[model samples]
Target: MSYTLDRGDLADLARGAALLGTGGGGDPYIGRLLVDQALRHGPGTITVLDPDDLRDDDFVIPTAQMGAPTVMVEKIPRGDEAVAALRALEDHLGRRADATMPIECGGINSMIPLLVAARTGLPVVDADGMGRAFPELQMETFSVYGVPGSPLAVGGENGETVIIDTGADNRRMEWLARGIAVRLGGVAHIAEYAMSGADVRRTAVPRTLGLGLRIGRALRAARENHRDPVEALADTMAGTLYDKVRVLFRGKVVDVERRTEAGFARGHATIAAFDGPRTLELTFQNEHLVARAGGEVRCVVPDLICVLEADTGEPITTEGLRYGQRAVVVGISTPDLMRSPEALGVFGPRAFGLDMEFQPVEDLVPL
Candidate 1:
């Protein structure tokens, strides 16, 4: 069934998506603002559709943002970049998109599909290529499951556009797209991995937009009810596809070393426990990739590593982490869909150049 999303729902959806982004999808604040702009541009309400309802030949497009997310904090999109990219892709294919969906389920990328859907009057699919956010282009279930990442269309903030039909392996497409994205000003809105409905149903992660919305609702409800918001988050994750949540660490941000390089926010951070000398270290390439506590590997990709405000359980993006802020780091395992050997080879720890085993967050953290 399709449903209308109210203005009231944006906050929760963005909040949930930020948490799930694992620190790398672009800022949720900007994402929400973009959605607000999109709403103002055309439709006041977003219509969401189930993936199962899609017909075999329906044209489905996935929308996203690519480049150093840190750069977006200052260089806000012009609000029409993604829509322009979608139109460019449609023109290249000589077919209009029947529906659109997120390429990722994190931060701005999570909301990009809705923005396109709102402007185009197409229903957004309740699915995404990655169940959560990943920094790089090839690290999606769609790629792992045999989907080409082109003919991809990338659009700049000022209407500059490029139509990419690499149609090669996703890795080659990633480099080609990343290089183009960097040239477009370090942040570009994109439409890629155009798929037929049958292919999307087979390759995309199902119902993740709904999952993110639920996460937002759960956290907001818990906070309003004076319950522990982190606890509420755990309870919500308990019944989801990406179960096995762990309070990885609780501390104050003591250090963050970051730089905008290779069109990505590459960095590391250290959090010191307030009550003890113990510390947790995080290393990320756009998104949190590893969590080490006292020199031990507590969690690694493709599991999610999230830093949330201690009291409110609100997710803090990489740029938002600052000294002395109280924070809690949580880890959530990726679903089996992203854990198979084939999937692991694409996005697992080793894929990130980390020399370690791909252990589920549940095993690494222990119940």
Candidate 2:
């Protein structure tokens, strides 16, 4: 299955990407605007191709903006950074890319690749490495499946380009990329996880772009029809990889502790019931990793823990959380591949330095 992404789909795409972002991936609002402007003068539409439709030898590269999420909102891209990065990588590889793919299907990263594809007239793979957003580049199915993460290409807005060609692993790639991003004004367009179509079909999370679009459409329809947006999201996600969705907490932000450390937005948020003492604490490194209430774990990383505006049903990223705002916390299960023992070793709670056993959201907190 395939769909053409045009300007009309920008809002829904951003909305859905934000929901899947799980409180990270940077803001999609700017990304939508950038893509909208590009479409106005560039290609009329971007074709999203299914992973299964690719030839075994087709070349695919995943693209994303790497840096602190907080920094991205302040320093918007030049609208050509992703394409520039892709071009640089293609040059370094001595071959033109066949298509672009999202490293993850969340927030601005999901749309960045679409912009690249639109400008280059390349189809985008319908799949991604992570079904949801992750803080580190290594926390992807590509690494779990033993795919190389370099040679990565990082590009800046002002004609700056850096090519990393090394035998280092994915973790080292992330470290080197982070330092380069900080040097390049805290955000850089990155092209990595280059793989053949056969590898993508074997390791990437399939159909996530379509899933995000469906989720965005569901929320919009729910709001228009005066239905419960949360329920609408749950129904829309039913039977998909993220099948279960539930409201874990209904409260207001009472306190927040966040700081940008080592090129990541590391923080924690405290939410308390409007009329009760029940409180929930969430910790994160770009994305929320753990959700606990009264010293009990309600949700953990790899499983999504999203915070949304209670009234608008719009997701609020970690950087956007503020004191005294009414919010609803929602949890969804991760895709099966992300929950596998090997996959979990990279993104599970223990991976984040938390001493807790990994548990599915469904088992930890019932809907």
Candidate 3:
């Protein structure tokens, strides 16, 4: 029913979260740091509750950081914001929150629940809304299961907060949340999708926490044994390692174009990756949505378009893309879990406003 937390578990959780993040969710580093720091402080204990364990009267909600993961690096959270989000949401709902659930656990979302659990003395559900990370709050399984995204509360670093309640429709809830996040400087703390335990069981991705713990373990083992972390990761995720594509001209970042629109971190990461006359260009919205080599479309989303350390094969999250960084473009499949029409309808190319159809990652990468 409950278990003690440790570094090993965190590692696995991060890894699993990354896979579940699909091709997005920012980076998992911040989540790792937050959880590690929280555990180090030893406020109390973190417990994982089962979905069926919750009572009809039990109050449950999902908590996560909402904003551009890129801005989070420059604008660090003020530490108490997560708890503040929970408190604000509870105050608005007029109900005591009995447990916290991860909205999605690809990156910081994974750790926010743990932080909330430790700080608020609530147990965390071992599940998440999306089996992997999605670009919008409305895109979660909760939406699929008919849960509303409001009366939600968002907390900021300076003790500022906002509560949103929409009469109907989750998409509007996402829009409001995004607008606030932009005003908050590309990052905001949020508590959303308040639901009953039975609802959570029906909507949340089951055993994701345990799955995250496993991913962390696989990465740790790969690092300790000097194995290729990517391969180790592939095996763990049961994902196919797509064949390499031509180097989309590897160089330093020259320009980055971004704008906060419709509650999504929409942007492009441009780099000069050629030594001579050959250069490349990449375009993305939430994740690396598309790539171009010599003006040719080389990679696309609905598949995993990832930037990794050339030497280490570590993934670079959407927010982590920066200038003057030399990284390799790696493409992997989205795993069958996310390849369904329901999943694609939300995160597929059309959802991001791209004119192109959703192509499997394998179709674009060269053999």
Model 3 shows how many backbone clashes?
13
Where does candidate 2 stray beyond 4 Å?
none
**lDDT (Cα, tens digit) per residue for candidate 1, span 46-139:** 9898888899999998888898988889888888889999999999989999999899999898888888877789889998988888888899
lDDT of 3 by residue, 1-367 (tens): 5565665467667665664454367567677777778777865458888777788767898889887765776777777787898889888778888899899857778888887877677889887876656677787777766788888898988899899888557889888888888888878889999999888877776767776776667766777788866666666655322223233335666667776564466777776664666555666666567777777666665565656555554556666667777766655665454556776676677777777777665566544
Q: Quote each prediction's TM-score.
A: 0.98, 0.98, 0.80
Model 2: per-residue Cα lDDT at residue 249: 93
Q: How many clashes in each structure?
A: 0, 0, 13
**CA-lDDT, candidates in order:** 0.88, 0.90, 0.71
Error of 2 at 93 (Å): 1.1
- Give the candidate number with the greatest lDDT: 2
Better of 2 and 3 by lDDT: 2
Instruction: Give the range where candidate 2 is weakest over 10 consecutive residues by summed lDDT.
Output: 161-170
Error of 2 at 85 (Å): 1.4
Please estimate how well model 3 matches the true structure, expressed as its whole-model Cα lDDT: 0.71
Error of 3 at 89 (Å): 2.0
